[model samples]
Target: MSANEVFLVAMLIIFSLPWLVWRLCRTDYFAPLVVVQIVMGILLGPGVLGRWFPDYHAWVFAPPVVQALNGLALWAVMLFVMIAGTELDLGQAWRHRRESGITAGLALGVPLLLGCAAAGVLLHLPGWVGEAAQGWQFVLGIGMACAVTALPILILLMEKLQLLRQPLGQRILRYASLDDIAVWGLLALILMDWNRVGRQALFLAGFALAAWGFRRLMVRLPEADRWHVALIWLALCGFTADWAGLHYMVGAFLAGAVLEAAWFDQARLDQLRHHVLLVLMPVFFLSTGLRTGWSVGGGEVFAAAALLLGATVAGKLLGVHLAGRVLGWPACEAPIIGWLLQTKALIMIIFANILLDRQIITSASFTALLLMAVASTMLTTPMVAPRLANRRAP
Candidate 1:
């Protein structure tokens, strides 16, 4: 076949595989959607087909197209945030916020500190990527990766356990939402620091705080569909962060915090998610898989990926167990909550991709981290859900 035809066909399959897998699995394999999408991309891209058909990844998931696909990812991320907001029952979150926050606190804090310490070590190793990875940037990348959670997977689990509307679920959801926002803001600052793309630590913090104040003042103007307001604000937020040399996701996330503060509705949130979930988000995933570059092969990369997998297992479970009691959760449920909350695949992959593309980290490092995230999600999901099946709310 002609090279252009090869490229066109590869693009078509990579983009369509997620929905196709969903259909093929009869939607049974829906929970681990990100993993499915990524694996399929690997099969189709440089991992397998791309090795033979090099024209595909270059033509399809290239800069211009990936940039366009990012808009959809941004939209999904925003809608996901809004849904998180609607799911937040203030009474429940406030009642449990102290403990809920405590849980979030431990989960994030440990990763931040440990990842920072681990950075020096992870940096010395060869990266899956070709770039010259540094000390603090290595630290920042791992720390941010440590702090993230995958909301799509979390939502699916909530639905499966019938925990979407329950008091426990509401509390967990609110805190998770808050945790996500905090992590993104911190990550933006970290990325800026690593790349020297913009201001350093103090400046980014001040900018974010000032921006928060400005946002609080502006969002006070209520709109008919707060979700739509959120969509516009999300785009603007991401654009702002991008302008500031931070990843656009940073801006989208902050805009979401403002949206949550507005008191949105479940129905509207659902509508927003439906709008972005199918084609846009799937395209984003495909693009991410293209970047994942399963072609990376080496012993050091494999070892580091294994370590990350172990950390995801031990660190997340321990973090959850530590904070479960304060939230009024029983022993039986605490472990489940810990596992499910730590499942990090899609969002981590997206965040990791930004760092890789910017040359802040090596592709191999990204690959290991991707492997870690996928392993964590798989390990956590089955352990958490089935155990809590009996305790599931109606």
Candidate 2:
């Protein structure tokens, strides 16, 4: 077959199989279609499908086909991250500064501390840390991974629960928004290259100037024109960030972060996000799955996943409960908030992908983190639905 033919076939399999399974199994109550696609990616990866059906795997995911899919995945994730950045309502967060700050801080901090402790334990065991990792890089990377809340996924869950536009849902977004800032800031710190420090500094300075001028230009343009201009700006920022030895994803986030969300129509923006998720992100999920490894043993990877899941879930609940006490929130609020914030499917996976790309974490560690993310995401709706059903809204 021609490469294009094979690539099309592969793409067909990528999109069809997940939807088929998701439809047949009816897993939406627990595992959303997105989560199922991620799981399907893992099953189709080298660790599972390749091991069992090596010849078929090799034929379907041939080098050229994989490369084609990777290009799609790269652009998909870049746009997804940019949209995530654009959605950051820091103005809303700032309006509720005290409540937002306290919740966001504790929600992020407690997991970080516990996750660091878990990292310390993992360090003692070989094959869990990456070859290029420094003691601090591995420790901090894993810690932040645990602390991450998948903002995109959180928004989806809230929409599913019919609380998306409610005051409660808006409040959750505020907390997640603040933590999103912290997550990216820490990632920048972790990814800092001493040898390329000058370039990094130049990138930041250049970005600031470009962002200011771009914002001015965006404000002047009509909304329709703004969309095209934003894509152009996304490419520029991504290219510059990659040139500076920071990741393109970071640059994509910055590109959107500097702009006002008010510049775009909210309904249209939401539709764009849904379209991206439906059409592009499954390829990203497949590419992510292709990277999963079991070199350290499946049992060990799963064991580590369980440990990290416990740390993440427990830490989030404990932290949010404490925040509730400090902020004088209603009694019914914290549990729902904690369970909702524990959604870590997409953003955590993105964070881990960057870590793996930087060689700060090995494939084994990435696999473990991937499992934890999947489990935590699966737990969110089932756990929160029951709690929210029982409790009265504040």
Candidate 3:
């Protein structure tokens, strides 16, 4: 809105981008780009001085600035998600599909079901109040949130550890990626239900068909001309989707899925990824870091926050374990898949923001849920997949 506000926002990005890149370039260990940006965000936010200097935070990470920075980040995120969707090869797992399907179902369905039940129980706790905080509402939201499997994180870590090329890595990544897409579809459905709109499902189905049709048409276009205006179209779609009551993410994500280069065109896909990953995605992750107000923690809020954290971790472990056995996830693959699919990331930030927006969940609850998500992701995803591979091997 004002020149000073605009200047502060730019400074945040300028500081964060290089900090993360430097960390990522120096060593692959502690600092992949996302983790670095997250750290940068913490240092820059209320977590540190925003904690120490309350007035500085109020003056700096203002509501308008947060919105503006996050808005800039959205495109990069959509690009990343789209690249993820496009990279999926249903055929890779088609042979193993039957077994992997069982593993994936346990990974997805079990967590989802259990997450809901966990929420139901948690919400009824005495004196708890929330937006979508009632029995069924709470249950369903937690279940799906617990069910979330972070595909991008999985791929990033796998690549970093050189696990992507391994058999276990391949099986896990392929299955996780496909299942991630499926889960997003389910999330979209939950949103439709949340909005009390039955027609959105049909609208999405039609959107899928249209994407397929457009993708088919794009293949016939001259190579350079095909991708030239793709980002423009996607941004336009994102704005339209947001205005239409469906989250901008639905359109943004689906646009990525639709425009993605298919299986045979690996080179083009790789080139496309270079642009989205190094450029856009970092912006998105950094923006997310900036948007989170770590300084908002309060006393009563912490207990509820703690409950959310506990529920999140316990829900995923139990949910995934239950489905792992029932779906016949090869004992090794099942537990591993359970952990992999259970990791949550920025999605919780969105959910927490939704609660915050409605004044349902306290700022502390938002902080706690986000912490739960990050902690769960860091703890579960990094170690579980590789270890499972070792155990499963003959």
Candidate 4:
């Protein structure tokens, strides 16, 4: 088949298979359609599909086809990340600063320390650290990956559980929002190149001046034009950041972070986020899967995943539980909040992807991190549902 035909075939598989499994199998209770899409991506990757059906995999994901998909995936994730940044509600977090700070601090810090230890263990072994990474970069990258709370995914899960507008749900959002900022900040640090320090500094200074003008212009524009301008801003920031030695994803997040959520209609913002997820993000997931490898051995990769999963869940819970004690939150609230905050699907994957792209972590490490992310996300609903049900039953 021609490259176009094969690309279409790949696209068909990317969209259709996940939906079929999600619908026919009725996995929504434990695994949402997004989760299934990620899992499906893994299965269709070189590790599984290529291993089992090399010729077919090669034909379908030919160089041209893969390139086309990657182009789509890059734009898709940038839009998604920008939406996440735009939706951060830092005003709310500031209003509840004391509580938000405490929870976000522990929720991120504890897992980070534990994950660093886990990284230390991996450092002793081969095939885990990337070739270009310094020791500290590898350790901190893994640590932050554990600490991530996928704010977007958390919002989705809370919406699913019918808690999105509840007081508790809003509280969770505040905590996650602060952590999201910290996560991105740390990512920028990890991706820092001493050789390009001057360039990065210049990018930040220029970005600040540009952002001020951009915001001034945005508020004056009609809503219809704001959307077009936002995309232009996204493209420009992404390009400038990539050129400055920071990853384009970092720039994407910053571009959105500076914008006010109130500038856009809430419903419209939600629709934009939803449509991006529905239409574009599946390609990103598949591209992510293609990057996963098990050169360190499948057993070792799974073991590393399990290790990271334990550290992530345990550290998040322990940290939140500690915060509950200090903040005088009810006993039951800690576990439910902990499980919910531990959701790490899209954001963690994005974090690990940047690390891999920068060569701060190997594909083997990426595979392990990917597996850990999927498992942690799947655990969120199941773990939180029973606790929520019991709380409401009385």
Candidate 5:
């Protein structure tokens, strides 16, 4: 087959298979289409498809095809991350500062400590830490991965659960928004290249000045022009950050973070997000899947995934429950919030992807983190639905 034909074949598989499984199997109750796409990506990856059908896998995912897909995935994820950042309501968080601070703090901190301990255990073993990573970087990266809350995914889940506009849902958003900031902040720290520190510093200084000018210009332009300018901003920031060795994803997040959400029409912004997910993000998922490997042994990878999953679940619940006590919330509220906040699909995978790209974690470790993310996301709806149902039973 021609290279273009093979690439089309790969694209067909990426989009069609996941939808078929998601729609035909009625998995939405437990696993949404996005989650299924992720799982399908894993199933189609080298560990599964390549193992089961080597020649076919190689032919379909040829170097040129894979390269084309990667280019799409990179831009897709950058747009998605920028949208996530633009939606961050830091002002809302500030309005509820005391509660937001305490909840976000514990929500992120507890899992971080537990995940660090889990990484520490992996450190004693072989094939977990990447070649380029120091012990601290490996441990801290894993810790933050476990602690992450996929704010975008969380919003989707809440919307599905019919709680998005509810008071509780808004509160959850506030907490998740603050954690999103910290998660990216930590990622920047982890990706810091001491050798390129001067470049990074200059990037930051230049970005600050540019961002101020950008904001001034944005408010004056019509909303239609803002969208176009935002993309230009995204491209420039992504390029500069990658050049500075901070990773383009960090810059992508910053590009959106500085822009006020109110500047754009909410409905249009939401539609753009929906369209991106529908059109582009499936490619990103498949690319992520292609990167998964079990070189450390499948059993070992699964074990690590299970360990991270346990720490993530337990720590999130513990932290939220502690917050409930301090805030004098009702007993039932903690579990629902905890379960919802623990959703970790796209953001965690993105976090782990950056780690793997920089060799801060091995493919074996990335595989494990990927598994943990899928499990955590799948658990969110099942765990929260019952609690919500019971609460509304009376």
Candidate 6:
């Protein structure tokens, strides 16, 4: 078969298999279709399919087909990340400064510290640290991954739990919003290239000017025209950022960050995000799965995954509990908030992908983190259901 035909087969497998499993098994209560797709991606990856059915895997995922899929995945994820950025409610967070600041600080900081300690340990071992990474870079990268709350996934889960529009949900969103900014800022720091420092500085300066002009122009344009302009802007920023040594995904985020979400209709924006997830993001997930490896050994990879999950879960609970104590919240609230905040899915994976791309972490390390993200995300709906039910019981 031609490469295009084979690529279509790959896409058919990617889209249909996970959806069929999710629907047939009714796994929505525990693992969403998105999570299922991620797992399927790993199963289809070289470590599994290629190891078992080498010829079939190779035939289907030929170089040209894989490259085409990757191109699709890249843009899908870039748009997804941009939407995530545009949804940030920094102004709302500022209005509720005291509560948001305290919670966001502890939630991000505690996990980061604990994850750093775990990274420090992993550095002593084989196949954990990337060859290109400085000791500190690897540690900080892993730490931030632990600290990340997948805001998009969190939003989805909250909507499922019927908390999305509630006061508690709004409060949680504020905290997550602040932390999202921090997560990306740290990513920029970790990915900084000393050799390209001048280029990066130039990019930032140019971005500042362009952003100001863009915002001014957006205000003057009709709302219907703004969407097209934003897409053009997204492509431009992504190109410039990549040219300047920062990843295009970082550029994608900045493209959305500079724009005001209020300028867009909330319902339309929500639908766009949903459509992106439903259609394109699964390709991104499959692409991510293709990157997974267990070269360090399956047992070792699983062990690392378990350890990181423990650190992330424990640190989130401890951090939120600390915040509850500091703010004198009802004692019962901490566990619920902690579990909700511990949800890690798309954002953490995206973060790790950047690290992997930059060679800040080895494939073994990426595999471990990928497993940790899936497990933690799967834990969310099951863990939160009972607490939410109890809260509703007058």
The TM-score values for the models, in the order shown, are: 0.80, 0.99, 0.77, 0.99, 0.99, 0.99
RMSD of each: 4.2, 1.0, 4.4, 0.7, 0.7, 0.8
Candidate 1 collision pairs:
128-364, 129-363, 129-364, 237-251
lDDT of 2 by residue, 95-180 (tens): 99999999999999999989989999998899988877898999999999999999999999999998889999999999999999
- What is the per-residue lDDT of model 1 for residues 296-355, given as tens digits with 9 covering 90 to 100? 475666677677666655666677777775556687777776676777877788778778
- Model 4 TM-score? 0.99
Where is model 1 poorest over a 10-residue stretch in terms of lDDT? 81-90
Q: 1-394, model 4: which lDDT tens digit per residue?
A: 7778889999999999999999999999889999999999999999999999999999988889899999999999999999999989898999889999999999999999999999999998999999999999999999999999998899899999999999999999999999999999999999989999999999999999999999999999998899999999999999999999999999999999988888889999999999999999999999999999989899999999999999999999999999999999988999999999999999999999999999999999999999999999999999999999998896
Task: Per model, state how many residue pairs clash.
Answer: 4, 0, 4, 0, 0, 0
Encode model 6's per-residue lDDT on 184-293: one tens digit a residue.
Answer: 99999999999999999999999999999999999999999999999999999999999999999999999988888899999999999899899998889888988989
Candidate closer to the true structure by lDDT (higher is better), 1 or 3: 1
TM-score winner between 1 and 3, please give it: 1
Q: Model-by-model lDDT, in order?
A: 0.64, 0.93, 0.60, 0.95, 0.96, 0.93
Better of 3 and 6 by lDDT: 6
Query: Between the candidate structures 1 and 2, which one is better when assessed by lDDT?
Result: 2
Name the runs in model 2 displaced over 4 angstroms: none
- Which candidate's lDDT is highest? 5
